[model samples]
Target: MNMAISSTPTSFSKSLKPSLPKARVFNLLKTPPNSHLRYTLNLKPPPPRLLFRIGNPKSKSQFKSHHSPIRSLFTGIVEEIGKVKQLGSDDDGGFTMTIHAKTVLEDVNLGDSISINGTCLTVTHFDTQLFEFTVGLSPETLRKTSLIELQMGSLVNLERALKPSTRMGGHFVQGHVDGTGEIVSTEPEGDSLWVKVKTTPELLKYIVPKGFIAVDGTSLTVVKVFDEEECFNFMLVAYTQQNVVIPLKKVGQKVNLEVDILGKYVERLLNNGVVNAIK
Candidate 1:
């Protein structure tokens, strides 16, 4: 499988600063044991946060972010599946998209961020009565991600940004897709499924047996790694098989792949001599 990277300054995210990499995939892929849904054991409703404000606050619920909501974390636990309702080109070299969803729209406001597949997108327009929302996609985002593969009626995994009180059963997922890869194969082992994905060597370097990876936004653990083949595999149990869109995909399909962020951070530190300075 061919894996490509784009360092283009534009972003698919309307909210992220130009520095954040363009989103690479939306058919993005993740599993349960590695899922952070378990971390949300704190069932208490999160204390009200100091909502970021805009020109004038109509209400606390109308808050918006002036920049990327990077402070927010995603635990790679999918909440629901959404379908693309409308898609078309915008004059600004981007696209306008409206998706049909319920769970992610419950309290969604003008600037709220929702991870479509594994890419975080801000809500630009929405309608509670219709259960749909619209967001803008930059051209770089389309060049880099599988979202370009999306069409009306395509299913996408949906996840909301984590609140102090939200449940976290998966691992910390940055929702910044590294790139796209092909689902090379799939096998079923009774009540579970074993799937293999082939990506580039640069991405495969961070994947290890038992390490965490977010596929299309579902947090899952790596079951095996095949360095020579530039691929890896993971299993989805009966429960996850039904909850996510991964199991439903076929061989040769493209899925979003976000290797754990920790590895990249460490690499950056090592390269910049931050680790050496600390030592």
Candidate 2:
């Protein structure tokens, strides 16, 4: 989905100057730049507000689900770290990506659904000896995801679709990216690790404390969520820090995000007034 960002016009900007609350105006005028008294006045405003959305904030979910719902489940347990061998735009304005992978290729077949950085894609071709597979991405997927920015040799988390016999290690992931988020900061907190990520306001609404979120195809529990800041916190255990690709990411690196699916379903039911109809 394309976002139309509107800049504040000269007239609107001028109007805002006088509409500041009296307390804010006094604080701004009297406080010194470096003084604690100016802290509140200098507090950063929240990130840009996005247009409200009723469906999954990530545009990938806006596409129709092609496979059966049962075949859509992913455990978010990355089977392997795949490296991009080739990535280029196709004549159709989409993209074609070939990944060098091993474990994920063990039983993979053409038409199999694979989760690459939390985005589900169908395998179009593969070479068993070379341990490589190709997937085509649509133009819409490129716009809403960070995958388009991937370069050759970039590493990505890979997972195959869940089977009934597979152990349920992580939360259910549909491989439908809700959006992309950037790592704002990372620091060690005593024995654990704390990482904060900035995201859009539309995506922030569905996030909750102790909620499930898929980051770079790994399911993690949210430690805290700052609605006003448009950011969320995640506490990482030693195992997570050692295994997931996110820990290797720097502050500015973008990560694919998939909000809890339950929130999307609830929003749909509420928006359609299904409860009222049932009554």
Candidate 3:
């Protein structure tokens, strides 16, 4: 009887004996080795950062394939000597002045090319309290230059236009103002400033004394040409009279000459090699 009782009770033999193996839920789904959940469940999502930006559109077709969309020709050098500080009246009577310049802001833009006293303008807008340009002057360039007799401030002389690979310097200036000259006197001549100018007896057989002249548009070096039967003076010296001033020049005042289209192509190839060496 005692043996029979042992076979059953004792909490049914401690609930069938084998307890500790309860941790096998497939070994708790097996991952733990160098853990990070087995490299985050075997990851695969990371590859995208080629950024370049600037007006971005994939670097705008590689910036339009290293740029050559052409359009680039500029020339400006008169640095300071600007006045006519306001001449309004636009919306079609055409005239929107405003130049109070001082070296025309050194590298001014907004459609560059200024050339005020010698005509050729463009600026159209600026800052630092002034720059605005626009000149529809025709009553024959407002009766042949003085920019309609300036005066609000006056003093002018600016230039900008010449990039065809530059270096031609004092010549090919197509800032195209053509005719207008008077300042027949300046004379100081030491710190330099001889000047004279006069022009238009048909630009007098292209002046020439030491040649190369531009006058109100600067580039001087004629030192003396004379030829008066009615006009073609020249003189010019240079070292800076505020880049050429004498009350912005007087003795009748007016300046802007450009003779030297390579001295009219070396005088038409020496008059066509002297008419082909007299045939």
Per-candidate Cα lDDT values, in order, are 0.69, 0.70, 0.47
Which residue pairs does candidate 2 place in steric collision?
58-178
lDDT of 2 at 102: 93
Tens-place lDDT per residue, model 1, 142-252, is: 545556556567789999989988777999886677777778889999999999999888999999999999998899999999999989999999989888889877777
lDDT of 2 by residue, 210-261 (tens): 9999998899899899987889999888877776678777766567899998
Instruction: Judge candidate 3 at residue 117 and give its lDDT.
Output: 57
Candidate 3 differs from the real structure by a C-alpha RMSD in angstroms, to one decimal, of 34.8
- Sorted on TM-score, highest at the top, how do the candidates line up? 1, 2, 3
Off by over 4 Å in 2: 1-71, 277-279
lDDT at 120, model 3 = 64
Task: List the candidates' TM-scores in order.
Answer: 0.75, 0.73, 0.27
For lDDT, candidate 2 versus 3, the one ahead is 2
| TM-score comparison, 1 vs 2, better candidate | 1
Cα RMSD for candidate 1? 13.9
lDDT of 3 at 140: 30
